[model samples]
Target: MESSKHKHYHVHDFDSRQFLENYFSDKSDMVFGDDTLKFVIDNLKQIFSEGHINGDILIDLSIGSFIHHLYSACEFFKNIIVLKVNNRCIMELKRWVDERTGAFYWGHTSTLLQEKEVNSDHFEDKEGHLRSAIQHVVKYDLDKENMTDPLVLPPADCVISDCLLDAISKDQDDYIRYLRKFSRLLKPGGHLIIIGCLDTTYFTVGKDKFHVFTFDEDFVRKALVGEGFIIDYCNVKKRTAVSDLIDYKAIMIIAAHKEK
Candidate 1:
């Protein structure tokens, strides 16, 4: 594990500091509120509509800071494999798992399924069973950049890319390369769900360029298609998790494999 709990990387100006300062200052809960959850849930519903989920989804918990996306995913599908390659992310994920309820919360980090509780209702059973709907939550750690290596992933039906790609690459070419690696993580015809932002201008947040790639929907669609992903659904949001800060907005891309 790295010396730091989280991997040290480039930081960009995203007004996160100001928001946090104001947040701790007791200015407003709106600093980083539920809009992201709404966006994530809405996008997820659209993805679900495009295909049927059969409890065999694999979510790239690539950045396990918040389980908002994971929780929403579990609600729709039963079995989910959450993979986090970063040690810090794994530690963070551990904090997100609730010790008591075994339910999903903002920053839980305990085991959702307890081994000692056999037939103890630890797993989420089928509907009307009074048990949790989500059964197993498999966890793995692999560095994001090493995802292409065989050791990082296992076969999956679907993959979720939430706030991950932007933190992985510096240019469009590298981003495409990264996406291709992500593609390989899934079985043929598996789905990839991505959510992140794009701004025309570069801004700084935590000493890094927050908007390294000012991606437009057209550019991203072209890139995904070029990289062998068949576009299933795409939604361009005028505002994202950082809508209050700048003129640029975010885009959500949900795609699947092209018929070969």
Candidate 2:
């Protein structure tokens, strides 16, 4: 597919609410629930449960307003700093954080996390905990050397990016460049956890077809290594559920740490 045919996320007006409803909602017919939501949640739970990724701060640079991935993260980090490339995503996230009306309901995701917990807490408590842990929701500029300039953030103990690279990057060089930026936000030895779709060209949300940078597992592994990261864990799940909304061969979760 020609890149020009697909819209860029930075130039496009993404319907954040519609995206949540389409994929993250509790609706029985959601397409990406099992392949994406469940896959990420389960891997995150196991990663955090292993006690290798806990720290004082975890920086989130994920796509969309989804918070399911952070349910397990709140238990491990005292603070979570969210960096968004667009205001739409920031507003959607703030609506949920501020407990405003019309915020996308994530109870279904919280429930999924609860089932994995040995001593499950109530949904309200889980939501409250995540909200309290989110320290800031700041805007970022990919073009800037300091993505979050004028608000110099302390080096985080861990950084989590979910599909943000693939969504924003135009090519392999852009992906590696963004990865370098994410690496700079972390302290040496700090872990970087990524959840990304593999071999995908585009994804649609409310009639907008957003370009997705296509890459394979070997490319990702090389990118991380070249950026001075030591891969600790990597998992890939082949696309199972059929859907016209997106074309992805697989989903990958990788846990790596900056070399000390």
Best by TM-score: 2
Q: What are the lDDT figures for the candidates, one per model?
A: 0.50, 0.90
TM-score of each: 0.65, 0.97
The worst-scoring run of ten residues by lDDT in candidate 2 lies at 115-124
Candidate 2 TM-score, C-alpha based: 0.97
User: In candidate 1, where is summed lDDT lowest over 10 consecutive residues?
Assistant: 107-116
Candidate 1 per-residue lDDT, tens place, 33-99, comes to: 3334555555665566544643465655443345545543554555565665444444444543434
In candidate 2, which residue ranges exceed 4 Å CA deviation?
A: 122-124
TM-score (C-alpha) between model 1 and the true structure: 0.65
**Best lDDT goes to which candidate?**
2
Per-residue lDDT tens digits of candidate 2, residues 1-260?
A: 56678888766888888888877888878878887889999999898889999889999998888899999899899999999888999999999999999888988888788787777645459999999999999998888888888889999999999999999988899999999989999998999999999999998899888899999999999999999999999999999877788899999999999999
The residue-level lDDT of candidate 1 at 150 comes to 41
